[model samples]
Target: MTASHGNEIMVVSGASTGIGAATARELAARGFHVLAGVRRERDGDAIRGDGVEPVILDLTRPEHVRALADRIASDPRHRPLRALVNNAAISVNAPAEVLPLDEWRRLFDVNLFGHIAITQALLPFLHRSHGRIVNISSVGGKIAMATYGAYAGAKFALEAVSDSLRRELAPHGVQVVVVEPGAVRSEMAGRGAATANDLAAMMNPEQRRRYGGLIEAVVAHSLAFTRNGLPSARAGAVIADAATVRRPRTRYTVGRDAALLTRLARFLPDRVLDRIAAANLRPYLPRQGT
Candidate 1:
């Protein structure tokens, strides 16, 4: 939208808050016309600014996806798409069995399939410009902790999809990169804690008796993890680097935790990782009942 900006466009989903909003701003500052996708009018208004346009986007909705495609295709300047940052996600922490099937589907809708939909819709522009796809993954993708079945599962699936998509597009010059971020200070941490508590409350008495303490530990640990985690702007800068670098790596880790944990997951045996996870959560677990 500015004369100083280049004739290229970038799309960042979930631009309402957290890393999404930060990444949108980062891309805009770097001189790309960034289309920041938010789910609400106020969010769009909040994020819209010079060199950054806001699109009302809900990836799970085909109409929203189509509209975004149309918007890009109809750009008056015909700015070719330069990158698409798939960043929309929701976290639900509960035992695999405790989380109902519908909840799992809901998570997958946004985390996995929704990204697929967006990628499929915009692949043409990417192919045209030989642009890249930056998937916002998580440390959870590499290691699955207790009460992380749904969230970790979705991220793992996204990681796999990214690999396959990268291979599939490499011959055509399109790049696909995955950015795995450790805990970040954001509203997501609070929402994850609230969601875990809500699901725990809905469990049957026997279910609660079986997993109540563990759920509480996870909630407390997640809050602490987020409290001391990386800043959104820092994480966004890493993502922006991944998106714009001349020769980008296939994958990047936003924080030291993500880098170390992902490496540990690769070499350590499952039993070892299990022990490590338990050790990390032990301090948060509740003591003997009153």
Candidate 2:
């Protein structure tokens, strides 16, 4: 076993499941003291282990965020913060016009503003330690599909925020990295499908006529993409590497699909990308009226 990274800490939010859970475990395995963030006591209990301490953290909750900051600041060990992985998110897929404004706000609340809240709170400690910040993004961040406006909107905004923050923090010895994973097999696929269907049911007749089939296609496509996606453990390792590497890249793309999609987004025109997206979704579209 490698020597322990005594008193060095890594903070990972959304550690209850999926990539967040895996990344928390991976960091602990790598010898860093990991503060894993979950939303409930039961989740915390489930994830607690050697070198891993689970904290109740729901990003949308102000009290929870403040409590975490206080805990870090007052730690008896006074561990230096090595990295902060912002991984909490909600997966919602619906047409732009069909998803209510409240839903859009909710998505941004968890996916974007929550991360910002955590980042802003911990930045003081990070500046003291010159630690890294890893934002978990997605392929959707770079390319919005037919029904991904809200989800991608937040991610795309995150990408832009990471860019500006990276430049702003570079001079201060902090490094900001974005990890865009195409798809990693996780519970999110199922949850997202449910969200999509729920939203589809609520759509007005005209809106359903326009987008009902499209919503079904997106859910099916999401499930298939996750089926072929990277394993959460592998994705976690990639993220751990991003957090701990001495000379980390500004961004890391997990899985071949992420690499391919990001590369295409960089080079392809909108029309071409549209056709490509349509082609991918074509197989999943519902057949007309049975």
Candidate 3:
């Protein structure tokens, strides 16, 4: 713990990599005591720094979640947690019709349920400090595209939960904010591409005959899009701002693409948006009956 680690504490989930890691570094640089939650001891060690305290936190596991809350509550030197960033999430890409129910459940387990569970566990500390809760969402939260349905669905639910939480916690002076980002450079994009390929590879003969090539092309396009995304550090800067700003907005759009797509979602009709989105897949769409 650094000199300032005693007074103001910020807990960031998924701090081992990507935006979460960058946010931990940024907040520590800004003089806030950052408790970075990672899944492994090695990850915790990797993120340790001047004002950052790395702790093992695996959202999918109840014991891990409980231990984190207990550790913070028991520590006399650390109290009144100022912020909680729910950034730990997994991306599973597949067409909704072909996606397994188990995968859907797993996605929600980490992206939605895990977030709610952690927030409930930490509510007491947050109330003591009138703290903020920043939920990391995505443009997919606003617009659902083909092949990314499962990921989008989880984000959509998160948006709804954040809305309800914000209103419910208003009287208690706890701010609940949603940070919707567009394509930001991170491991998630690469993982998404790999998952897409894996899913396609796992398809049965009939399923592969129907959608394999299309899935491969979509994954390639997704990888390219990710390659052009904003840096993770840029997103971290926005998250840090959202956490510390005196009067933070209820929702902060992080990337240029995020800002534009969110606006387009609001203005465009569903049918129009659907057509625009499908245009990209047109080339890869399989011919009828093969």
Per candidate, the number of residue pairs that clash is: 0, 0, 0
lDDT of 2 at 206: 95
**Candidate 3: worst 10 consecutive residues by lDDT?**
1-10
**Candidate of highest lDDT:** 1
Candidate 2: tens digits of C-alpha lDDT, residues 20-125: 9999999999899999999999999989999899999989999999998998998899998889999999999988887899999999999999999999999999
Model 3 off-target regions past 4 Å? 1-6, 282-290
lDDT of 1: 0.94
Q: Write the per-residue lDDT of candidate 3 for residues 1-290, one digit (tens) a residue.
A: 23244478899999999999999999998888788999999999999999899999989888988998997787767556889999999988887767899999999999999999999999999998889999999999999887888889999999999999999999999999999989888898888888888888878888887778678767776777778999999999999889888898999998888999999999999999999887866765556674
Mark the regions of model 1 whose C-alpha exceeds 4 Å error after superposition: 1-5
Ranking by lDDT: 1, 2, 3
For candidate 2, the lDDT comes to: 0.92
lDDT, candidate 3, equals 0.88
